[model samples]
Target: MAEMLYQRDVYGKALVELGKKNKDIVVFDADLSGSTRTSFFAKEFPERFFNFGVAEQNMMAAATGLASCGKTVFVSTFAIFAAGRAWDQVRNSVAYSGYNVKIVATHAGISVGPDGASHQALEDIALMQAIPKMNIIVPCDGPQTREAVIACIDIKGAFYIRLGRPKVPTVENKGKFEFGKAQVITKGDDVTIIACGIMVNEALAAAENLAKNGIKVRVINVHTIRPLDNDTILKAACETRGIVICEEHTVIGGLASSVQEVVAENNPVKVLCLGIKNRFGQSGSPSELLKEYNLTSFDIEEAVKKVIS
Candidate 1:
């Protein structure tokens, strides 16, 4: 069998379908409607769509206002703006008010390709996860992203959906979905690699590579960041003697930080984090950026080998 390459179009189609059935599910964008692909919803439901130019702060406030009117408003923008620029509005309005607002921030991490550091959102998960009443989700691929959009529609309070620009492979094909839960893709007793978003694919690939060397590695997708899946994480840590945390985002406050907190209190294991260090990425293609920032499958393989050794 061959590996699959996912597309973002599937998520757009799912959003269109959800908009047809749920009138309360409104869409908002910050000028980059085409880039984020929320324009599909805008075309289908013009009456329920609002574009706030490049004003991400205004868009966040407006989404909160719309949510106040009993609407499930989904505000879409580049992750950099949705979480970084509009952090104040998101924290005060949507999070503090516990509004039914969904924030879909695309182009997360170094996967934004040639756009480089300015467009890449390396701290979105950490930034949004810090807010109270915020549900943070980082779907692995297009199909999962679609499921995430549907799940966010009725999820209570405020939520953040982190998306990447690069097409990511769908790790799960079971056609099931849930919020605030981690998906354990594979089982192993040697080591566990907990990752999310685009890094999920890399982690799985690394696990396969490690298997050839007689180092069985388990892979878990911690898609939901805010409500850290403590149960699954601790279970994996206890089962696997050592652990490796991976993500496209910065290591400071991303998946590594989340897993570290859980392991500190519950299960202690030799842990390694694979992500961009305290450095900015230069302009390059997505693949090039991954290599430059050490966010590739090879990097994960090397990290696993090092941890085991």
Candidate 2:
């Protein structure tokens, strides 16, 4: 695997590249330009960047207004504020109006170490998934995050792209990313592992370990949470006979819930959802938190075993 890179930094650089190509692109940040990495674009296009002094709701409303005036607006902030604080504006002004506003929130999930439960956004995915006409993308690595940003810009609608704060290893699958398509990284007949965001890497690691134990596993990256690739998931379920979903967020309304909904409706199979089970995040290092919450590769391997058994 390549050296780890911060997904937020990749997003920031991607925005600068997109800004140069599309002059109509505008950026807004809620006093977290540096942390969110929007400062890279702010430096390049000062005229098109707006810093809304910690007012996430106002910033989202303004982004919707800018989109109304033919501008492709991209808003950045912490996931908690962007999805929790400004949820009303995002649903009403952005999704309801079908505005071309991209909400690229950083520091998502329990990875925002040292911030405690309040700052970490364990329910952002659940909150955003409930909104109609809102697209969601949770990229796993730096390269995928960059591609996700470009894809969101090219697509016309309201988008919520969840990004992480910690640097993660680059994904080995160097394939083109299509919105609403799940990439199958590995193929197997015993079980299937579906994951999004940082959990994709964990799933891959689990598959490798499972291979040593003579248990074949298929690993899929469900980068796009909403508008889920039901066809791919159904194929995996039919072929593998069982499924295990791993995610950094809560199991309540995240990738696990989405996958279960599809599996229950079409192909009923043994499904194991590996994620936080009705709990809140706590202060710790990213690695420590992941282990504490049973989000590591070992946890995924165990989940796969449980489903297959």
Per-residue lDDT for 1-309 in model 2, tens only?
477999999999999999999999999999999999999999999999999997999999999999999999999999999999999999999899988999999999998989889999999999999999889999999999999999887788999999999999998963789999999999889999999999998999899999999999999999999889999999998999699999999999888999999999999999988898888999999999999999999998888888877
lDDT of 1: 0.85
Return the TM-score for candidate 1, rounded to 2 decimals: 0.96
lDDT of 1 at 104: 83
The local distance difference test score of model 2 is 0.93
Error of 2 at 135 (Å): 0.3
Cα lDDT tens digits, model 1, 138-216, are: 8888778878888877668898888888766667542366788888887788989999888888888898888999898
Candidate closest to the true structure, highest TM-score = 2
Question: Model 2 — which ten-residue stretch has the worst lDDT?
Answer: 168-177
Clashes of 2: 0
TM-score of each: 0.96, 0.99
Misplaced by over 4 Å in model 1 are 1-7, 172-175
Candidate 1 weakest ten by summed lDDT: 1-10
Residue 8 accuracy (lDDT) in model 1: 49
